[model samples]
Target chain A: MVLLKLFWSFLQIGLLSFGGGMAALPLIQNQVVDLHGWITLKEYTDLITIAEMTPGPIGINAAAFVGVRIAGVPGSIIATVGCVLPPFLIVLLLVRLYLKYKNLSAVQGALSGIRPAVTGLIASAALTILILILWGENGFSTNLESLNFVAFILFAASLIVLRKWKPNPIFIILGSGIVGGAIYLLL
Target chain B: MEKRKSIYRKLFSSTFYISAFTFGGGYVIIPLMKKKFVEGLKWIEEDEMLNLIAIAQSSPGPIAVNTSVLIGYNVAGLVGALVSLWATILPPMITLSVISMFYSAFIKNAVISAIMKGMQAGVAAVITDAVLNLGSNVAKKKELISVLIMLIAFIMTFFLKVNVVLIILFGGLIGTLKVVLHERRNKGGGE
Candidate 1:
């Protein structure tokens, strides 16, 4: 029964999470923290860190993390399955539809429109994280009181490295991780 | 042509490798997949890859997973899709399970948390770059409707906190309407 509940929670997460990893965090928080109280807000914040830090999708990582916390290995497995099931099925159906109607004007227009709108959501998500990291999570502020200059520097450096050298992004992430550790420990 | 069995193995291994190696978040994996499939393997065409990714995002669920399954199905079929999906999610499960064992210790570690904060800054950069790339691509199309949709969607999401699903649906509706009107206007010309 506990495992069943765990599965159901993550299943809802998979179904509802549309945009990307950052976009899904709130819904995951709502299910695991707010609704079920499976893990406290403190843990949810940690989950975000680990989820973003770790490989693959945040939704899958969160499911595995929470499942383990709640019900161990079996719980995590069940939750992970639940998390993936919806998208697995949904995308397959969409693929069939797209292949058939891809030539249609309506489909083309919808694709064009959704592409930009999706980009907008991604832009918003990036800003959300930037606000939290640079200004704290209370929303963007003009006071500059909580602005983190080190983070700003790091963000600038990473952007330059990415735009210029075009190395694998993993290198930038790992490099920033090291730089971030040194900066914060000194501060 | 390569044997179907070998192709399946290649697909599974490629996704598995990417899944295991990719860090930060889902979006990070996409460019890597494009590199592997479009450039490295030359199996999927450039526009085809974009179309698949677009559809993947158009549907619900994690965009990474959605993209992989679509790519897999596009390449190999349903069985290929299944292979890609499994390969994609397995790494996170294994890695997180181990991390969960040391959850408290991991969270409490000063160095790790500091690194996390730093990694987040880097992640923000990466994601911001991705946004810029996507935005510029939309801009390149030189379509006013999409540009306007992109702006409106940004305002709605950032300032208004609208659910992304609704925004996506709204975009789809607008797109459909634009094309329908376009077709009607052009119907008589039949050109």
Candidate 2:
């Protein structure tokens, strides 16, 4: 039953999470944290942290982590499969339809309209992450003032370099870790 | 026969490499695809690549998966799509399986934790930049309406903790209605 629940919950997440990993965060958080009580908020935070550091998409990582947490290896497989299945199915259907109506203006217009909405979804995702990072569990307390600005600077700088230069993300992630460990030791 | 064999080989090789290296899911795969398929192989022109991205974005699947299918199809039809999809998913599936095996030990590592913190900040920025670039490109009245709808959905889900499935359904309904109404107006004007 727990494995089934994990499968069903992640399946729902996969079906609805349109804008990708970052966009999937709040939904996954609500599921794991609020609905099932499978994981605590801190654990969710840690999962996000770990997912970001790891090699796959955040949504997939969350599924793997939560799946393992709930029902072990099988759980992970179930969750991952559940999360991936919806998109795969949906795309297959859309591809068929697209091949049929390859030049319909209505289809074209509808797609154009969706572009902005998708962008909006992406923005909302960014806002949610920002709030989580800045406010933490207390919801906007004086604690945010204590954020490691130096760490923030390094992060921002590394990202800027990444954007302009298009360096490999793995390098950036690993290098940032080293820099972070050094900073942690120094401070 | 020789020509067909070469095409199959190319398709398999491209799909295999993409599946192996793509970490962090679909979006991360986009840049890499741009590098490999567009820059490296010249399989698709930039315009076609951009159009594929736009289509993938508006479509109902994971963007990376969708793109791989589309690109693969464009290159070698159904066979290509199948190979690309398999390739795209293989790496993560294998990696996740291994990671799951040692999940507890991996999570407890302090150095991993520190690195994750740093990467989280960077990932956040990447997401932010994507939003900004997208917003700048598509910021108009209709776009604003879409943005507003998105904001409402976000607030409802994140703050009010409403079900995200409902939010997506509602967005889909609104999008459908807007398109239908616009089409009707256009028809009326034509008539």
Candidate 3:
């Protein structure tokens, strides 16, 4: 039952993941965290980190990673297959028809609209992660005590450093890991 | 003339090599695939690879895997596409399997947990940068309708709490409508 659930959830994720990998994050979060209760929001963020750090397409890596966490190797294979099967089939089909309508204005029109929406989708995803860091999932409650000042500070610093330097994400992630270990561990 | 079997062998081995070593995400692998197939192996022409990349990007999947399958199909056939897909997936599966083997134990370590907690901020930052970059790209396109749709989509998800799948469907529909109206206007004016 668990195996079937994992496969089905990831298959849905694979089918509708438009725009690109990062754009797919919110969708992945919705299925794994919101629907299946597979991982916490915090752990979901960490998985994004791990997925970003590892090689291959982030979506496939994520399916494997999340599946392993849920149910081990068999789970991993099943989930990974679920995640990839849609694209494998879709792309093959698209390639067959692509040469015909490669320049369809209606297609370009649809993309133009979807592209901005994907930007919004990523923005919304970023906001959710930001909220989780700054406040609990209760989402903007009146409690100041639960707020993580240190994390907020780090988040600000990271945003600035990324915009200014554009360092590779691996560095940003590892650097944060070191600093996080130093501050929180000592405190 | 290389035997048909060698084509699959070449696809598997070379794709495995690139996918194994390449880090980050799909975009990172494109150049490497280009270098190997376009420059080194000369299996595909430079222009053809560009077309494949564009189609791969426009399609609804991981660009790396999509590109792989396209290049594979170009090289061999459907079988080649399947082989390339597995080739692309195996390295990460191997790497993540080793990591997942120790995942529970790894999560338990105080040091690792703290580090990950800190990295969460980093992750948030990286995502923020993506939002800004993507948002700005849309903005740079300078379309009033596009910008409005972006804002409306953001408000819908972050504030109104609409399901993203619904938004994607609606967004695509609106996009098609936008084109149809524009084309109709052009035709009417021409007539």
By DockQ, the better pick of 2 and 3 is 3
Query: What TM-score against the true fold does each predicted structure earn?
Result: 0.84, 0.65, 0.64
Off by over 4 Å in 3: A1-79, A95-99, A141-143, B1-92
- lDDT against the true structure, each candidate: 0.83, 0.65, 0.77
TM-score of chain A of each: 0.79, 0.62, 0.59
Winning candidate number (lDDT)? 1
lDDT string, candidate 3, A1-187, tens digits: 9999999998988887875687789889999999888888887876776665566777887788888888989888998899889888888887787556757998767666666765575577568767876785567656788788778788889889988987655567668878977899999
Error of 2 at A42 (Å): 11
- Estimate the TM-score for candidate 2: 0.65
Residue by residue across B100-158, what tens digits does model 3's lDDT show?
66765765688866876787777677767766766786788798988988899899988
Q: Candidates' DockQ values?
A: 0.60, 0.29, 0.39
Q: How accurate is candidate 3 locally (lDDT)?
A: 0.77
Q: What share of the true interface contacts does each candidate keep?
A: 0.74, 0.32, 0.65
True contacts kept of 2: 0.32
Cα displacement (angstroms), candidate 3, residue A52, comes to: 11
In model 2, the Cα lDDT at residue B45 comes to 70
Q: Could you tell me which residue pairs clash in candidate 2? A: A55-B24, A56-B24, A57-B24, A57-B25
Native interface contact recovery, model 3: 0.65
